[model samples]
Target: MESFASLFAGLGLFFIGIRYIGSHLKRMTGRRFRRAVAAATRRSGTSAIVGVVAGALTQSSNAVTFIAVGLVTAGLTEVRRAAPLVAWSNVGTAGLVLLAAMDIRLLVLFLLGLVGFAYYFDVERSARWRHVVGALLGIGLLFLGLQYIKAAAGPLRELEWMSAFLTFAGTADWLGLVIGLLGALILQSSATLTIMAVTLTGLGLLSLEQTLVLVLGSGVGSGLSVAVMAGGLSGSARQLAYFQVAVKLLGSLGVLLLFWLERDGGVPLLLAAVQALAEGTALQMALLFLVIQLAGALLSHPLQRPLLRLCASLAPPAPAEALARPRFLYDQALEDSAIALELVEREQQALLTRLPALIPADGQVAPPPAERQAVLEASQEVVAEVERFLSEVVQRSEGDEALERAMNFKSRNALLQALCETLDELMTALDTSNGSAGPPPLSVNLTEAAHALLDSLMEAGGEGEAVDPQLLRALTADRSALMERLRRDLLRNGADLDADQRNGLLAATALFERLVWLIHRYAVLLPDSLAEGISQKAPERAST
Candidate 1:
């Protein structure tokens, strides 16, 4: 009972320390880490190095994978570029496993003692150092937990039940594989399972061959866990997850085949190589874990193109992902300021075209809330990309004309972003007003007005149609007086409307009015030829 309790306690501490370390390190690195990942993708080698560093720091490949996914989703990096980072990060996770193989009992004690002193002096209270202290404490706890597990091994081996289980588990190599897989699935971390296998091997409870098979299973299990957890993701994100799954499965299974060859056919492969390189069961297991990760990297790196194709086929880019990607802006354009500014303009216009989709056209049914939100999110993503593209243009631009055009594009981009946000809020307000009870008469009118205004803006911004500044100025003219009168009348005569409906109606009208003003401002910023007379006249009318 005491041994069982110690084993469980050790497992608990091990998991807790991993969680603390991963979570705190993530918080500590935060945006800077993300930026590093985003920037590192310029070169394959740099990205790989960053990936390894990320895995080492967080001690979690899953976290690193998601971070890469997020960067891809944000248009900060391409899926192809992010693939190396995700692949190499597995190598970084081996650092902890290797550390565990060594005799670090004194080191663990010293770390725990240092953590105690830190707490005693209130180092954890400092905002900057709090995460540092927490991560250090997690390290101490992690190794201390390892020590506990190792200590309990002797007592566990003395038990008849444990002895029988170990003997049964080692009788067939495949059985150990299954055990490792299940253990990793339950723990959601292969490293944790592999470490346990390492400890058991060192204690003579399990053979080195059993530990090898178990590590292979744990590797494959880790991949399965990622695939299962990321099931809900789609598009490039899903593709990236699939890439991770491929790396793990291929690497582990490939090595497993070699192990089988060595054991059954008298072939000298990974097992022979591992035995030749390292002594002792624990050290050999750690080296094998690293070798498996390296094999995965080595095997997958050469087949990157085919693997990426496979991943894409398995999880094709969703329509929203396609929409979110910038269609016009490319890095190469940045070299030529003129081309960069032109691309920015084209991208902004593309975004401008998406604005009308926020509201359905005449006689078309309004899209469901989920569809609407997806469209809005796609537009927002493109807006972010445009902003980033323009910033780069600003830095590279040389002369006044180029600089002025970039500034003009920036201001226009800002207006477009505002318009997107207003439309989003307007949709929410309209949805609220059109409750389950049905659309109120005021809601119906507001919806129609929004549809007509968005149509006019779309036409004016379209490529084929020449910008009719006067027409836009009149269309988007101040409707404050009209909205105010409508509001007053609704309060007096809206008897059927509940409080929620009434508030929704009021908010919708206010957002619609602001929407019109934003359109007017956007028109005034149009080119001199387009805004010829209205730019001079619209501001005065808009002030009223």
Candidate 2:
């Protein structure tokens, strides 16, 4: 009973360590880590390498798998690239077992000491340094947990019940597989089960063959975990999860087949060769596991395209997904300032395109109030999301390009606000008129001017052309004339106009003048080079 408690306690600590390490590593890397993976996944070999490195460092292939899934779902990476990523992550997870096979108490102690000093110096206050300290503490806890498990399990061999159980476990080929799978399912971590197998092997409670079987089952368990984790996901995410499961199942089957063949005199041949090169039974088994994993990856590589096609057929992206979500502001790109800024600019452009629709067409019936309100609400949500995304991008911005991009985002935000305000003011003025006759000729002309300026700006921006500052100046040059004309008409018509009509006209004209100035301000604020680029692209697009 005492030994059982100790073993459970050690397992608890081990789980804690894994969680700590995975979470802290995520914090340290932020969304940039996902971005890096997306970029590296352009090539299968590089993607696999990234998978291995990420898996080894985090000791959680699930972490790597989900990251891949996220990038794929966001359309940041292709399914073919993610296929090797998942395959290699499974291979990378074996590193933990190898690390546990060594004596690393001294290393653990050093790490713990470093963590202590970090805490004492308050270095952990910084998010980046906090991740480092958390990782160190986690490693220390992992080693300490291993020691506890070793101590607790070592004495189990002395009991008669344990001795009998071990004897039966050795002869029962399927027992290890069943137990491994069940334990791993309960723990949600194959690495946890593999480490236990390693500990049990070191204590003489399990043989190398049994350890191998258990580890293979653990691989299957990890695959199932991925599937379960991805259950709620759709589109590319679900496909990526299934791909991971397939890869792990293939690896497990390959290893099991090799074990079956080894029993038929093939073992003696390979064991003889491995024994000559490897020193320990556990080490030999770990090497075997890694080799089988690599073989499985190679075997699975050819199926990448088929798997992708299968996933696409199985789960096509929903049509409403684009409308329901922010298409360009993906979290994966948020850490890359260039990509993120571009995405923000794209979304801002989209928002601007909707502005013209809010303007009432001459003689057209007004849209229902409910419909207008809904549109405004949706626009506000998009505005909030874009602002948050830009804030994240700016936090990571450093270079001149990033700085310029941030400034551009700010200017675009200002323009969007002005556009929304202008729309609201126009709506209010129309309401004040009690939905009476159409807007006066001056108001109509002002609306036309605003629409033209908006359309021209959007077109020039889209074409990568700088709006000639002179052209913008010309557009706003008539603003003073329009304002004076509106005021004169308001006074001359004051006796004929109701108090509400007078107020509405004044507010509407004032808002229109503000809109013109806002546009001019944004255009002027744009850097010379970008303005030049836009101007240069404009004529080409027009000619084409």
Candidate 3:
């Protein structure tokens, strides 16, 4: 129980350290990672090499493979590109295993020292250092665990049951292979199993040929882990896992045939290759066996596209998001003055539709993930369609009043355009969120500041302002002001912000205010001779 508790504690610390490493890595390498992932999944060969490097660095192919699977399921990566990486990952593990087997007891000592350093380090002063130190400590514990494993296995070698098992495996290669494969599958640790194979062989209880069969089986059995993990994954993801199984199984079959050649009178050369590493230390022999495994990495390139096709066949049909409600003011049959003014008014209303929900609906305490994504995408399309439609209206503006109102709508809605974009970002974060992210307090204050300005302006009702360039200047200034405030707030508070997020909140206060101000300009444009009492009314506006 003590040993198990210690192991679990080590694991707990290791995962926490990995989380820190991944977080820092994201900030430092997000742009580079995007390009790298794109390049990887585009071609099977490159993907394979990348996978090997990634597994080697992280020392966990499961994590790398799962990432590849998720990307494939999301349709960002093709299965073909993913297969090569999966193949290369097995080869990568061999290198890591060899390193672990070597006497680098320094790993454990360093970790013990780092725990002391990290425990005393100041967080703000040593944020990045803390993560690095923590990660190093975790790696050290893992190596130390291997040392303990080596110690534990030492006694098992002397047991009568163990001696009998070794005798049975040495003489019966097929049974030996089956036993090796089953042990790895059951233990779920190829490294641990490899260590066992090496330790037993070193103890003189198992011959090189017996250990070699087991080594080969370990590679083949490792495929089962991914298959089980992929069960809940989508079709594209499952195909990625299945592809790994197929590649490993096929490789295993080739090894089986090589065994046949050696057993019969077929290939002396193949038999010689199999015997080369059989006489060495189990750890060294494990390294040599890995060379055979490394060939799979190269093989993965050729098999990439086949995997992609399989994933495509298995993937669920892609979801489409094209149906959106359009927002237009009353029809154009009204007078030229009324029509242009109404169009601007109608577009303004359309843009303001999501304000009540979006203004308070966002922050750290977000709305439902799916609903947020839908609203965001929906808002973007609305803004874009409005912009395109109004660009034409801007071209059709006739007199000073009509032309002015149209231009005013163009600018105000431009602010809405920003809102639409920001809302989309908030939605994406909310959709993927765990809901403990709390609130974006700074952004909330910025939004409230904006609403206050809008209310102030509306309550002031464009008093004493005329249709001169000053009116245009005021509208544009408000737009710029609100956007700047939102931008500043977001810069300070936006840890994981997406695009549409800041824009959505900014739109409510800045863009909506500008729209109302512009309409007030339009109302002013009507000739005193032709218009009556319109210029005297107060403005009451709502921003979508």
Candidate 4:
């Protein structure tokens, strides 16, 4: 129990370190990863290598899989070409496991203390350096944890139960394979399970053969994580995960076949057959593992389409109404006035998240109503949620300061509702084709310029924190000026274009002007109470 505790603590720290290191590495290499994912769609051999290399460096198959999934979902890549990424990720994960299994000191603790002291000791900008140093230190702590686990497990030889288990595990191939599979499933980390197999083999309780079964099972086990991740996302994702499992099951059978062949004395078995083969020696073993992974990858591509077709065969795809889902609105974490302010900012981000579906015909910006769905839904939810949150906060707090912020919260919510109402009205007008006067035509560039100004204002309005009333007014004026300029240009060029072209241009002009009004309203929604200083120190901010 004591040993297990020590081992657990060490491993806990080690993983946290791995997480920190992974994050920094991810941020540093994100652009490269993006390009690699894009290049892989071309099916160029070099791009496939780049894909695998990035996955290994990050030590996250989930991350790579997600990227591939996004690209596929976005129609950027054919589902057929996406299979190699899965194969590449699984193989890359094997490399990460090998690396994480190495020993390292708990240097992250030392660095944390050093950074903490340096920051307090008036070292200029030391705190700013803390994040990078902390991440590096986290990597060190991760290894230290692994070391402690090793030390703790050293006592297993002295424990009767441990010895019995080990002996039983070593002697029984089927049992060992089951344990390995179950353990990997529980851990949700194939790498972690593989290291355990390697460690157990080193302790001499299990032969290399027993460990081999477990490692193979571990590959199958780690897949449970992907299954869990895909559970929330149905359709293609669910089918993809299911098919991947079938591939793994088949691959496991192949491993069993190879082992059975060796036992038949058709070929002399190497003593090292049990050990996980690497690039070092037993190139055949490495090749075998690669083959299984590649097979799984190849099988995954055609399988999804077939699976989808099979599903269709069994029961037709769900009707559009059955599968219809409401877009997820903004997070509702902003109940406290301080938190509500922050929540508004996040909701604004959510609004911008999917507004691209509405890009204008000119491709400069989205249609006004279309843009509002993403932004309006996000803003509406946030404002409503914050109002609810502030109500609770106001009831609980004692201080006048808290009370004042609550009032400001109400004002912000009102502005949010106003924006929604305005947008709803605009969309209705467009649909109704109200004989409202359309703006005059202009140069295509000028029309595009007007659309751009509107989008910027919409984006800025959604970005609630740093919003300045002066900036809002400037955007409003800029949009109005662009509309006037575009009107003049349309009159100048209207005669040059064919009649059909002229009609199309006029329709586009009307849509762009309406969108401009929508954006301008977003800027106008910013009340004095919504800005940072005003809400935070209500009395002081008001005075300023």
Best by lDDT: 1
Q: Which residue pairs clash within candidate 2? A: 464-534, 465-534, 465-535, 466-534, 466-535
CA lDDT, candidate 2, residue 323: 33
Output the TM-score of candidate 3. Answer: 0.52
Off by over 4 Å in 2: 126-128, 265-274, 321-347, 350-544
Residue-wise lDDT of candidate 3 within 1-544, one digit each (tens)?
Answer: 5545654564454344444433443343343454476467677567767877766554455656776765554334556666777777667666655765466777567766766666676542475565555555555655655455455556667789988877776678778777767876775545446755665566566776677678667667766766776777655567777777666665555665665676675666444664564444656556545654665555545655775566557655333122133445322422365475576555555445444354342233445556655666656665665565566566666678777766766666666666455445533433332224533554455444434333333223232232333343344353556556756765687667555554454444444444445434533433343212324332422221
lDDT per residue, candidate 2, 1-544, as tens digits?
Answer: 8888888888888777877877787677666677688788889889889888877776777888888876665556767778888888777877877887777888888888988899999998986678888987887787778888898988888999988887888787688788877777777777777777777777777878778888778778878888888889777678888887778777788878877787765655445655677777766766766765675577788877886687678767644233324567777786678888888878876776666556555555556665655565556556666776777777878898888778778767766666676666766675564526646665676566667776655544433334665566566654778687878877787676678877777777787787787777756654455556666777988999
Kindly report which residue pairs in candidate 1 clash with one another: none
lDDT by residue (1-544, candidate 1, tens digit) is 8877888898889888888888898888687678778889889899999988998887778888999988888777888999999998999999989988888888888888988999999999999899999998988888878778878767767889988887887678788778778888777778878877888788887888889988898988888888888889998998898999899988898888888888889989877887898888899999999989888877888999999999999999987887888888777788999988878877777777776666866577887778777878888888887888888889989999999989888888788888888988998898888767778877877788888776666656644345575678888888899999999998899888778788888899899999999888877766647555546767877999
Note the Cα lDDT for every prediction shown. 0.84, 0.73, 0.56, 0.55
The local lDDT score (0 to 100) that residue 476 gets in candidate 1 is: 87
**Across residues 485-522, which tens digit of lDDT does each residue of candidate 4 receive?**
65577568667555545555555555555555555555
Candidate 3: Cα lDDT at 249: 61
The lowest-lDDT stretch of 10 consecutive residues in candidate 3 is 457-466
TM-score of each: 0.83, 0.66, 0.52, 0.52
The best candidate by TM-score is 1
Ranking by lDDT: 1, 2, 3, 4
Error of 3 at 309 (Å): 4.2
